[model samples]
Target: MAKLLLCSLAWFTFPSFADNKPLNSPVDYLSVLLSLVVVIAMVFMLGYLMRRFNVTQHGGGQMKVVGSMALGTRERILVIQVGEEQHMLGVTAQNINHLARLETPLEVPQASGDNFKNKLSQLMQGHKGKTDE
Candidate 1:
């Protein structure tokens, strides 16, 4: 009985590596690489489809955010243009309220060639001259 038990234990205890085959062949590696490439291509294709369909875009047709101002930490004022009319909205973290509607729509400013740093330096110089006088 002891001999039978020892023989059975030894038979099950050790894994046989006599076959000694490598886990992944070159073809296996190539298949894995091809699968990864296919997955990445699918992700990019999905992104392209989403953008082409404008799935995640906002304010496309009449309504548009013309300007916004930060009031506090989590509060803002937004000027939105819808067709010919403009509306000012007060927005907070928890609530949105209509402030006013402008009779004439505000013109959106165009970006000029003047850099912000140059304008800031000019403003600082003007303030210094005023303080000296």
Candidate 2:
């Protein structure tokens, strides 16, 4: 077991020793930093060019998220408007379910300050209070 441990230790330490060649010339920290900066700049440039050319996006028709409500810690209910039709979906970490298709679609909630939370709570409450007709 000691022999195995020694062998493993030697194997790990071997690379450090191999790479420890005496510096033939002074290490230019500035040049190394400049090269790193150039590489990062090149990556950003390429990303910008790709985005400018729209290379990373697949063309799917836009679907609007009308509204959403959090049911629990990893679960949500979403109302999505695709084209003219509206869909209510139950979303969880596990999977999504089709909840209902509204006959009379609910109005899109107006975005407000802290009142948005109040509106959301009220909306959820209203959903619970009202029965399906």
Candidate 3:
């Protein structure tokens, strides 16, 4: 980050070949539009790369939180599974700490496809049964 800042400062300090004239030609406008497109594409490509590398960890996959228990209003104990190993973590408002590493992995149940849909249908059916009574 410092390097980038320094490089940018250096860039502004250096002389440029650009005339700094106002855009007057269709070719100049086209060039500006193309540059804008390229910058936008680069931004999207960077986002794709970040998601592909799991940098943001948006979805549950190999690493997932198995369970969590709240200790206080601001603190909790969490069990997270990474690959086959399960780890206990202590989380607070300030920071997170690793509590322990489990020798035996905890079994987590897998949800069926359309889990929310199934749950909602079951609730609707239960409501109908009560009203029919």
Candidate 4:
């Protein structure tokens, strides 16, 4: 047992006596570190760009259920609106049954000759009323 322990200790320490040369040159290590940093920076930059462009907004709010069209006998397409954006999502009969409990409009109303300027004016008026209140 003593011999075995000594042999094991020697085996562990033997590598420490060998030449301590780094596997990669200093320049190579620096290049690798720089590449890693650049990759991380690029990833963060891409994320920032996506956020700036509002590319990640989805599926949250007083969603307007546009339609529930049949896909199969059991599955259907569920079209929903989040803010001004619309999304058509696939849903099963289970989801359709669940959706039936919610106060979804039978039909979304079309703009009654109201243009962008009128909408903007209405929004501004609403904002002014809120501020006054």
Model 1 lDDT vs. the true structure?
A: 0.73
Work out how many backbone clashes candidate 2 has.
0
| lDDT for each candidate structure | 0.73, 0.71, 0.76, 0.61
Itemize residue pairs with steric clashes in candidate 3.
none
Model 3 agreement with the true structure over 91-133: per-residue lDDT tens digits: 9999999989999888874543357779889999999999999
Q: What tens-digit string does per-residue lDDT give for candidate 2 at 29-97?
A: 444455557657877998999888657654345666778999899999999877778899999999999
Regions more than 4 Å wrong, model 3 = 1-58, 112-133
Of candidate 3, the 10-residue stretch with the lowest lDDT total is 9-18
Clashing pairs in 1: none
TM-score of every model versus the real structure: 0.40, 0.37, 0.42, 0.29
Scored against the true structure, residue 9 in model 3 reaches a CA lDDT of 46
lDDT of 1 by residue, 1-133 (tens): 6469545543443223223444356664565466557657877998999888657756558887889999899999999888889999999999999999998889964323335667888999999999999
By TM-score, the best candidate is: 3
Candidate 4 structure, TM-score to reference = 0.29
Q: What tens-digit string does per-residue lDDT give for candidate 4 at 48-130? A: 99888657664335776666678688888776766655666768856533342324434555433446668889999999999
TM-score of 2: 0.37
